[model samples]
Target: MSIVTDNPFLRLSGAVQAEGIDLGVAAHYGNPMIEQRHLLAGTAIVDLSHRGVLSVSGPDRLIWLNSVATQRLDRLEPGESAETLLLDGTGRIEHDIRVLDDGTTTWLLVEAGELPGLHAWLDSMRFMLRVEVADRTAEFATIGSMAADPAAESASVRLAAAAPNGLPLVWHDPWAVVTRGGWQYAAPEGHPAADWRWSEVLVPREELVVLVARVESADSGVAGVLALEALRIAAWRPRRATEVDQKTIPHELDWLRSAVHLDKGCYRGQETVAKVHNLGHPPRRLVMLHLDGSDTVLPLHGDEVFAEKTRPEAEAGWRVVGAVTSAALHHELGPIALAVIKRAVPVSVPLEVHSHGEVVAASQVVVVPPGAGAAADVPRLPRLGVRGL
Candidate 1:
């Protein structure tokens, strides 16, 4: 068997074909059904052998991590995992990951295929932090699931468990060790199990392979990339590289509530987060889009969205607040997308979601703090300087 490098999708029987990527010799034996089942019914084991896994060690690892990431890292107990953000100096997200605090070491699980870059980023920042970073993405295979599991939420880490049928339950989580069931998963040629990368329930990869595999298996090999895309759009989850814009501020994306610590001591992007929340408004707001069937394919990433007054509105449409980071045709909902709209647009007005030549219907999903939007005067906080300028 040829070694699988950056693209772990090649390991799956039909992922390469369904995705339409040329996998060279692997194309000779394609099984789309197996790929589909990995998403919907039985347990499908996927080799996310290509994801970026990093080990951040040293006595100062905790303090060093606490300073760079948005979450309060100093307090996480072993076996605990969380969705965390890496913010720019302005408090905007640079990257996001599922951070795991294994009793002795801290693992930064980044999107698949980004390990080398993340490793370099960690290295550049290692001026005097006493932290050492290593890329171990190729060391092990990771499996995942949204399948129903009776044993889920146990003493051990449960990645995800859900029952689709009345009595049919499935357990889903990525397994790090070796396995040879319906599917055979092996680390790219040279690597052995001992070099197994960080294995956990949380998904830190940028791509959808791990989650897709779990869904395919649980769904009896009937799940497809399209179905997973629909689920993601419905969940309103951020797609990291796609949904987050370079100029975007994290708080506007709701990172404060889900990804940041307001009361924690200063870090690099503290000032930006505080200033935006206290003195200014969010530049863009994340919104869900509904696409019409006029177009067969979903909108492309970075497509513009228009809110206009004329019948076949064009030049006068509202400039894009942000673009389509990710989109998919839903099984139940036809077509759907997640976009970042400018705050200036009225949330109540109906809008047109557009790609190069395609247009879709979109409505804003207003996200206000618990008691906000209902109150006459919204509360405010004072600003102060912290680690980030």
Candidate 2:
């Protein structure tokens, strides 16, 4: 039987449950601004039980995972964490997974909506390999926070994860810096992820009441899903569930910085991965849109983004260049969003977001630049003997 994921945090006073895409979880605890501050201070915990948990075990788990994923996992050490993407044959993203190895077993965390597809794919691919895959969502729940290290001496509360084989199940995000065999497309000097210390800890389902007690006693703070979403946008974090579409490739959102290993061995979509990074550019690019505050409205995903034409026709209609992938009303930034725009759009040009019968004037803060990828730099040798004719 599937376990019901009724969130325990919703019992708290002023804890408003989020609706729409991420339902069944708290959206905020009365004050979103205060919740954001608490998260940054590492005193707040976000309930992520709605996320899916899967496991793979046996001797060839890492090798099997490495053979099919975008990141190298064959040599992953115990307690180490990584992230990977499962792409379709044509190079479009299908599933985004957070990977953590604990010696005896590897825990895979994914969006709840993607659990079935991911599990089915893994089970089918296990042919004769010494690997096992199972859905563990019934036995485990996910907790998210900005805690850099839960094992630290100065940690606010002593929290532990399920450790059937002695290694705790904590998946630290590797997005703060570019990982090995990866490339960075954003301007490196002033990237926003400098202060992003996000991590997810997996605890047994029965411990929900224990965590609730801490929040009740004021020993630990509890924030809502909106708090995390706001911070994620501010940090320029691109999550596959929100940022990716049917046509998404790693380079488009600067996702190659962490989720992709360019030098990895052959995988499902390596041909397209190599071809785009070395010889071509992603058709679309990612940008942060600083929305006009006068409108006082948030743009939803798939909202059309337009740009004024820079061509000879001065009176043409506003052309649609891209659409918003995710947006949030940040505590500090007023209204900001992460959008995927055309690669040909000029970085300096201002943008407009059409949402809720209003057009919000916006400006682009480049994330994945128009010229991202094509790092090979192979010079064009003058053709045979016809040099400079």
Candidate 3:
């Protein structure tokens, strides 16, 4: 059951619910281009109620979580935010969380589908700990803003001030910076997320009405998941549902940028993470595809992506290398997508995406380059009889 099934915001905004948790508010309001523009200009709010919230309260909250998640959380300051990932024994990504800590409680923000499993795992791990994990999704709703700092804006300011329990809980994105214990896999020059100013604030479920009323009267507009997604893709951000496959490892998606703390203490799957980062390349790599717009067709998730064979005698005309994870029509970039292809796929080859019986040509924009490995840069020893000896 959808948490927001009875949400008044849907009727108030005349939002058309998307296939899943996404309520297409912009789809309802019309003019997606304008909606996207508003989002980029930091003059819009997005309903992210589909996301889940969990509260962890106890004296050992930070320490216990630090032992479980990839990021270093023991030192996370009050009101500070960070991202972490849960990996399987082989370092395959299972969960991605956005974390925020208040003085007394740690809040975890995750996909709606992840709540039950995440809560269950956390509970099972609390056999002897002082922590208490509870699913707070039913009590709190998330509102997102791309504003550089939501505290400075009118809409966010109004929402923050109206928090029934004091200031609205805001999770400012830490993706823009290379965090204290995190490493960057992308080249330092021009990572797309460098300018991303994302923030999500928690508002009481009942207080959504007040926030919605304020937005309708203000000059700022309301955007839907569509607008948020387009911007996120353009920034080369990796989402949990779209980007993650059962075999996905954090290195494949350049997740080291924000989610993994290479220097963090031991955690589950840490060995595989360290092994892959220090000794081997991930089997797959994430890429951004700029599709040819002449076809007027966009690839959907799970659409096959192929590499066009150049030789005349090629056995298979096109080899399947990957599948599209997320696709969107950017207001400025037209059609674009993020796909996870085999790491061996040559970056220079022309690509094609097959979706809905239509083939769309694509050009690769490297996100996780083929050589993204050995992030630790450990020096190799000289040969036994080398001159240096």
Q: How close is candidate 3 to the true structure, as a TM-score?
A: 0.92
Q: Could you give candidate 2's per-residue lDDT for residues 1-389 as a string of tens digits?
A: 24556678889989898887678788998998889988888888888888899999999999999999999999999999999999999888999999999999999999888998889889999999999999898889888888777545477644568887898888999999999998899999899988899999898988888999989999888889888998999899998788999999988989889989998899998899989999899999999989998969899999999998878686766889999988888889989999999999998876899999999999999899989889898898887779583
Residue 130, model 2: Cα distance from true site in angstroms: 1.1
TM-score top scorer: 2
Per-candidate TM vs. native?
A: 0.68, 0.97, 0.92
Worst 10 residues of 2 by lDDT: 150-159
Candidate 1 Cα misplacement greater than 4 A, ranges: 1-13, 17-47, 128-130, 148-226, 309-321, 367-389
Q: Write the per-residue lDDT of candidate 3 for residues 1-389, one digit (tens) a residue.
A: 23555655576555665665454333435556677888888878887777889999999999999999999999998878999999887788999999988878899999888888888988998989899998887788888888766655554433452243344478988888888877777777888888798899887777777767876777456877888888899998999988998999998998988999989898999998898888889899999999999989989899999997766664658989999999998999999999999998888998999988988999999999898887666788988877862
* Clash pairs, model 3 backbone: none
Residue 373, model 1: lDDT of 16
| Order of candidate numbers by TM-score, starting with the best | 2, 3, 1
Q: What lDDT score goes with residue 39 in model 1?
A: 39
Clashes per candidate (backbone, < 3 Å): 36, 0, 0
- lDDT, candidate 3, at 284: 93
